[model samples]
Target chain A: LQALENIQLDLEAVNIKAGKAFLRLKRKFIQMRRPFLERRDLIIRHIPGFWVKAFLNHPKISILINRRDEDIFRYLTNLQVQDLRHISMGYKMKLYFQTNPYFTNMVIVKEFQRNRSGRLVSHSTPIRWHRGQEPQARRHRNQDTNHSFFIWFSNHSLPEADRIAEIIKNDLWVNPLRYYMMGEGVVRSWASERQTLERPSCFRFWIQ
Target chain B: LQALENIQLDLEAVNIKAGKAFLRLKRKFIQMRRPFLERRDLIIRHIPGFWVKAFLNHPKISILINRRDEDIFRYLTNLQVQDLRHISMGYKMKLYFQTNPYFTNMVIVKEFQRNRSGRLVSHSTPIRWHRGQEPQARRHRNQDTNHSFFIWFSNHSLPEADRIAEIIKNDLWVNPLRYYMMGEGVVRSWASERQTLERPSCFRFWIQ
Candidate 1:
């Protein structure tokens, strides 16, 4: 009887131990809590920068990089970009990456146009697309080269636009890659029809 | 004797089952493997996109978004970014992010000036910045307006540059927030720079 009692106690003890271990592991990796290091310190600190640069630039250690790859550390795997209807761990991480500021800004810009009826506001006419909600014609032509320059500049500079673009199918987001892909199409649709890309000396920022 | 034998068998079975469960849990969450559902589908999938957009764009839901917060989800935590001489989960994730394409390209651009000796090759003359260890002077002025425009544009479009700038105090990365903070100092540095904030016609892509 005493031997049987000892065996029973040992089994119960192990069961309890395993249960505790399982909970601890789940909390450590599965919870939506803050990470150990903060963003500013990670990005601004010299030591961290050194490691990132070395990991990225080292020919031997950073072998994951491809010659033609645009963004070196870009996280656009096919699995990562798929339709995420179901609730899986994959969905959880995606939720974190998608709503990030870069992607959201792209969405806002895409929505800057259409009204409640989703009508395309003509360039020549002044319309209160939002704000006061008044039907007024556009006072200034949106074709200013400066605006185009800014757009082009933003597109070329930030890979975020492309990542955000991958998240949406329709014209509901400002996709820099798609815009650049438009090529001459962009040159044709000038709201105010301000200036052209002529004059070789016209400060071509795109030529590298 | 029968009871003791039965008890022994039950303990063995329970031990095996617990062992199996522990392995399953580790493989499911602990290992650094790619999640299912491709990247494009994950972001572009209507269901996932809807959730993300609702979570991010909804003022009440995505209150975390500030200006240019896309990279906030980006996991360059300080400990991860630090010396990286140490091995860790943060190190592993950072390794994945840095060796990715976007980051490497940025590094190439950052190293555009260094010669074989990692010395600064001045921008006034024709120089082989990229070489088989040959030293040369730069063909054009790095301070050209076009260069300034490209740098300025990059700084505003993505926060990566600023984060990188923090990693290195020098001019390798163009940090917009820091530049903006310079304010009057920047204006003082540029005399021939022209500006026409005409008619409130500015198309700010940032304001949501």
Candidate 2:
């Protein structure tokens, strides 16, 4: 009877260890699936700093020439645009912060300008961005007048539009402005909006 | 006495729940410190593919010319190189895979030829790769006997090289071949190796 009891005890111990291992494996899978944090040279903090330069390492961007139309819009992850201010030196474009209280990162191609080196010369404007509010175009700076730079933020996955959207949605800031989100994933929803916002080749975004 | 026993049982239940919560918090903190994953056009799966392409979309690449020397090599994430294959095309370059027996991704600046617009022409050679072995350069392809291609992969932490270095060291692959890594973090150790490998501007990695 004692030997049988000891065997039972050993089995119980093994069961406990197995249970813990299972839990750890489950947690590991969940951890891997969880959205990761994105560290860029320049991070637009939701909390504003006293300085005008809100970005950390103001990243220089470049242009990809002679690719297919479809390929041109792809790969915006570390995509850089240069001298966008020349589009409208002091123009304010339309943008919004939903999932995140802050409209952190936006890839607007038209306004971005590049040198022969394909480096972004234009500085990303900070004033136009506000928390829990919709971004608007500056009519006064109306250099082109019709230029509306619309940007989208997705969940906080750190890369792609969806995660940023998720981050924004996690906070749940539904604005009472003109905004429509259409699509299933992060890249698609934002890309859909981008296609809608894209106009003719008149500084339309790609050509410029 | 009955009421006291009931209260004790309730306390034990609460204790169990509290223990679980504490574990979760501790794991969360650890997760925050862990490195993130990079989502790209194609991820050579560490696992075998039931799917042909791991990533949803392939990204477009671009070339940046006439930038400062340091600036030229600054962005390797999406930085494009055109006709780089000419550097030592059909050339011999040495490589190795430690933690991962496969050096999955290689950025061949010169060998990776692109069109005028900037797209990868040469599909990265898969012949040199094996599941659990170090890679060897193709001597027959060594048109230029002096050419060598070296690369580094860092953890996706948004910023910082050390996290990647930690990831690399976590598995610890000490090879018999000549290799030296020096850095407080991820960017510097491999960077030092790059400085040594760089021969000249004849499609020298930083320029071309």
Candidate 3:
């Protein structure tokens, strides 16, 4: 009878230990959930109204994401004529955005390259293109280049740049192969036009 | 007395609205804080003991928390020899990580260019040093050229090459202000490793 009682006591001890372990796990889980939920809400709240509406109107029963929603934003902005040609595939986009500082300017550029044999092969060497928000009159006169792909959003402050960068960082979901970030003060000078590749020449590393 | 009572009631209504607004803001604050705290904790937990011991030994009481801790992990792992230059810099660091199958290599290369005025400028361009990590090593030993700087990183994939191209996108960063990302496919077709001012004929868009 005493042995039976002792066995019951041991079982109760084991149950209590298990309960404690479960509670600890519960606390950690709660801690983990808190941040994830908050970020989810933040993302949902900050999506542009136009994007939301456009997505709703899509025939596929959801939103359609254009190139503007892609990972190429920060890299594509503030390009120059010299920088546009390296983009081998789509050299013909005609739309252009001028830096607010220089109303006469009408383009932006980003450069990309690929290795061929032992040599570096670039289509345009330094790819250049027109920013997408120019008036129709300006665009037609600049007919030498195709301007089909440029998209424009209002330029925000550095903090906004940081937020956009964060979104890019978090949603690097499609291609987990490369990650990129702009270096501190690696942007165009304050006096420079936004649509020109007049960024300061300095050594800045891009995260890959 | 009735009018005075109505005024007090209006004040109570205003207070209630204010309280509701405050509550909403408080909820948002908590929401944002939840993810930040949890993410921070997750980061803290993953740090290895060696770093903890190192940091504890040399705590900078006045240091600002500017960079993410994951940057250290990037510096340690997936690090190619090209990163050694920046790691030599004692400034605060930023890091980005990737695990793409195509990201097989990293290398460092120097580019030399002459500006419009014909002034020679030398700059180091970090190439995605992959299978052909150092073309300059072979070229420097075999060929004799008066190029200002002689180094280059070579890689197999264009996307991987872009990872380095993105780092040195600024023209002002390096003078004659030019750089290149040479793919192995392109370099293999080059007629000669030694090309120069007298031999513009050797210059080809796709060098192999």
Per-residue alpha-carbon lDDT of model 1 for B172-193, expressed as tens digits? Answer: 1111122222234555344113
> Each predicted model: what fraction of the native A–B Cα contacts (within 8 Å) does it retain?
0.01, 0.00, 0.00
Model 1, which residues run further than 4 Å from truth? A1-9, A25-35, A38-55, A58-61, A70-208, B1-208
- Cα error, candidate 2, residue B190 (Å): 16
lDDT of each: 0.24, 0.25, 0.27
lDDT of 1: 0.24
Candidate 1 structure quality by residue, lDDT tens digits, A108-147: 1221122222121211112113342111222143222222
i-RMSD values for every candidate model? 29.5, 27.1, 28.3
Number of the top DockQ candidate: 3
> What would the per-residue lDDT of candidate 3 be over residues B28-90, giving only the tens digit for each residue?
333433443344334333543322222222212102111222232233221111111212111
lDDT score of model 3?
A: 0.27
Give the winner by TM-score: 2
What shift in Å separates residue B10 of candidate 2 from its native position after superposition?
84
Looking at candidate 3 chain B, the ten consecutive residues that score lowest on lDDT are B170-179
Q: Which docking class does model 1 fall in? A: incorrect
The DockQ of each candidate is: 0.01, 0.01, 0.02
- Best of the two (1, 3) by TM-score: 3
How do the predictions measure up, each by TM-score? 0.16, 0.20, 0.18
